[model samples]
Structures are given as C-alpha cells and as structure tokens.
Target: MEDISIISMLLTAVFVLGCLYLVIIPFFKDETFLDHTRKSHTNGATKEALLTTLNEIEFEYKMEKLSESDYRQLKKQYESQVAKLMRDEETSTEKAIDRDLLAEVEREIEASIQQKSKKGGGK
Candidate 1:
C-alpha cells in the first residue's frame, strides 16, 4: 500500500511538472515574439492608413477641394513616409534572413569539424 501511494504521488508530480513546462517554455523561448508581432501589425496598419489617406488626397485634389500646391505637398509627404516604412520593413526582413543563414552555416561548419576530428582519431 505504501509503495502504491508513493508511485501515485510520483506520477502526480511528473504530471504537474509537465504541465508547468508546457505553459512556461514558450515565454522563455522567444521573449520578443509578442513584441515582434505587435510591431509588424502596427507597421501594416500605419502603411494601410497612409495609403488610404493618399487615395483620399488624390480624390480631393481631382475634385478641386485642395489647391495644387497643397495637394502636391501632401502627396509628396505621404509618399515619402510610405517609402520609408517599406524600406525599413525590407531591411529588417533581410537582417532576419542573414541571421538564420549565418546560424545554419556555423552549425554546418561545426559538424564538419567534428566529423573530420572523428575520422582523424580513428586512423
């Protein structure tokens, strides 16, 4: 009876530990996951808003609601902002790709070194 109780308690503890691990591991694995998601979402929303405003400005200008100078200035400003956001997004994407490629290359180099040492040692 005592042995049975101890085994049951051990199983219970293991189950609790497993549950805690599943719940807690993701937070540690990528602490910036939420931040990255929010930043991308905000950038997308801002870009969309700017595009919409640009369209509205064009429509207003066509309807003669804005002076020619004002319309040109607004169009230029919004176009510059949109261009900047696109450039920033592209740079970040390139950086992430570069990091991943670098990590893979490092892993391959390490693996090659290990294989060479193993073969040399066997001889």
Candidate 2:
C-alpha cells in the first residue's frame, strides 16, 4: 500500500510538472496558441498586412466563407485604406524633402554671406 501511494504521488508530481511546462514553455519562448490562430493588430496593421487581409478575403470568398457582397465591400474598403495610406506617406516624404532643401539653401546662403564679409573685411 505504501508503494502504491508513492507511485501515485510520483505520478501526480509528474502530471503537475507537465502541465506547468505546457503553460510556461510558450511564455518563455514568446509564443501562444493564439499566435497561430489570430492576427496581431497591436501595432496597427501595415501595408503588407492589408495586402494579406485582402488576399484572405479573396480566399474566403472563393471558399464561400464570405458572400459576394461582403467580399466586394471589404475589398473596396481595404483598397481605399491602402490608397490613403500611400498618399499620406508620399505627402510626408515630400514635406521632408522640402524641409531638407530649405535647410541646404539656408546653409549655402550663410556660407556665401560669411565669404563676402571675410573678403570685404580683408580688403
């Protein structure tokens, strides 16, 4: 009876350890069951994510998981969002270029002024 109790205790400890490993291992490894089954929307989806979602929508439509109307609406919405994002990015880039150009021109003007002052003073 003591031997049976010892074996049961050992089994219980092993079972608890196994359960802990199953739960804790993923935490240490930076993974989880949801990682495989769901998309990460934490940082706001990127252009690539939008493209992926579009593809997924198409696939779902083909599989009849989405209706034709739903697919069309979703596709349109994603395309619009992508277009707007691209436009915003382009505008920001243009503004940055303009700022850089202005800074360069200011530096050139300052250098020209310095040279003129030096030449005039030296004379």
Among all candidates shown, the one with the greatest lDDT: 1
lDDT of each: 0.97, 0.86
- Per-model clash counts, in order, read 0, 0
Best by TM-score: 1
- Model 1 Cα lDDT, one tens digit per residue, 1-123: 999999999999999999999998987786587887899999999999999999999999999999999999999999999999999999999999999999999999999999999999999
Model 1: worst 10 consecutive residues (lDDT sum): 27-36
**Per-residue alpha-carbon lDDT of candidate 2 for residues 33-123, written as tens digits (9 for 90 to 100):** 5774343332236777888899999999999999899999999999998887778768867999999999999999999999999999999
Q: Which residue window of length 10 is worst by lDDT in model 2?
A: 36-45
Listed in order, each prediction's TM-score against the native is 0.67, 0.54
